[model samples]
Target: MIELSFAGWFQCRLATDPDPYDEPRGVSGYVHAYAGEPDLDRIVSFQPPPFRRTHGRDIGVAVDAVAHEGIAVPDHPLVGATVDLLDAPKFEGRNGVVADDGLEPLYPFHLQVARDDFRAARAVVPADPSFPYAELFAGGVEFGAAEIRKATGEQDLTATWAARVTALRAELADAAEPLRTAIAERLAFLTGNLGADGGGAARFFGALMRYDYVLSSEPEIDDPHGWLDATDHDEPWRASFWLGGWDADVLCGYARGTLRLPDGAGPRRSPRVPRVTDRRP
Candidate 1:
């Protein structure tokens, strides 16, 4: 599996197809999860970080899960963490192409960590056994230039490279302290991106993230997703944190407060946020 590093800052917006009429537009509003924080001063030197534009399947899945499970969104804010997709399955369809349906593309995609995996998300059991096994979300990890330094074969673990890795780890450790705290205080963390507004377990998860984006007027969302008019401010409403070993503990701690299964078991063992090797090689 190829691993890419993503900084924990991005914008939440409606995923629109550049060609609105000709292509299938994504159904869901989504955040543009970027490789690094958008820097103004670095704009001239900034290479646009490699990013995965959602075809809207992730948001659609979240909406379906919330509706199906009868989940509820909390009145307060919730932190939304991006899952580690190192081992996620790359979705592919026949012809490796998409059909033009005016909605998001439905074929030849990869979705390593989809919103449907959250605890609050329940698969819609179809009356007909074969409903085409459709998955709304697609697209896998998009690698950036940083990956060129990845070591391989006997050339791996050069002294200088090891030093750089050690330094980067140290820097990340230092920078993550405030980011973790700020994230915890600013929003409620989720095992995955499902949100809702109900009681008990439902109170903890829902489609709230999308709710915030749709309500923000700073960058009004187009109406493909049936989003309401602006009702909230647009100042860092949500972000996607890369929870690798360097910051998993901090991120997980923030999420643990409300992230639990219906049986009252801890969420770590749950499929939404499984424990795995978080270290970078």
Candidate 2:
């Protein structure tokens, strides 16, 4: 006597007993792909006594039945039936979530099934391009160091740093209005704190390049300072100060109409001016 179980998101059952179990079984293994459909009636016919019954079946049901039989059921209507166990894809850490494909960096949700299973299943396309992270960065606001590396052999650190700064400046010049101003101000603050001489700029730029890639990709990210903490730098307070200045400049830009708001986002309220505190000696 062979016992089989079919388990997944879809509901299904195959049992030799006349009265099949009411509850669905828990998913035990990763999803798999099979060559052909299972013949429920033929499979039930093979079983002794009460005979098996299939209810709300899926591909998993056929795979489970084939595994139990231990031999191919060639005579059944569905021919060349075979189960092909699929391998899982590689997942890398992005933002705070683990994802396989290069989806929106800020999308925190993920779904995984075997390759073969996915190919056989229906493909669902998202209606909006910025789903999952749409509400977070609706304005498409993105900033951080731009790519300024040249693969022209090895060069002196000072020369390399100068070239990078020049490239960054050129990129900023092409940016739209106040966004350019916001980025330029932030970059100046960062470089000034790190210092231009004594390899400080080079060290900071290296860290900035890596960190900025992650930051720019994740448009929905809320805490810029938090992400900047991942950079390889001893003075984390620099990042905090830089982010504060960047946010202030961006908000002011929006208020001044130099920067445009996201679609459907109403006009921004005027930024509150800080009151000067009087101190007497």
| Highest lDDT model number | 2
In order of appearance, the predictions have TM-scores of 0.17, 0.18
Tens digit of lDDT per residue, candidate 2, span 1-281?
A: 11111111111122111222111221221111111222222111111112211111122212222111234333322122221212211111222232212221212211111222121111112224443232111111233223212211223434533454566577777777555664465456335634646554233222211101111111221222231222222111100001100111011000000011122223434422223111111
Q: After best superposition, candidate 1 residue 92: deviation in angstroms?
A: 4.2
Residue 12 miss distance in model 2 (angstroms): 45
* TM-score of decoy 2: 0.18
Instruction: List the candidate 1 regions with Cα displacement exceeding 4 Å.
Output: 1-77, 81-92, 96-119, 126-281
Clashes of each: 17, 0
- Among residues 3 or more apart in sequence or in different chains, the pairs in candidate 2 whose N, CA or C atoms overlap within 3 Å are none
lDDT of 1: 0.21
**Model 1 lDDT tens row, 74-158:** 3211123232212121211222233222112122111121222321111212122333223222222222112222211112212
> lDDT of each structure?
0.21, 0.23
Query: lDDT of model 2 at residue 162?
Result: 49
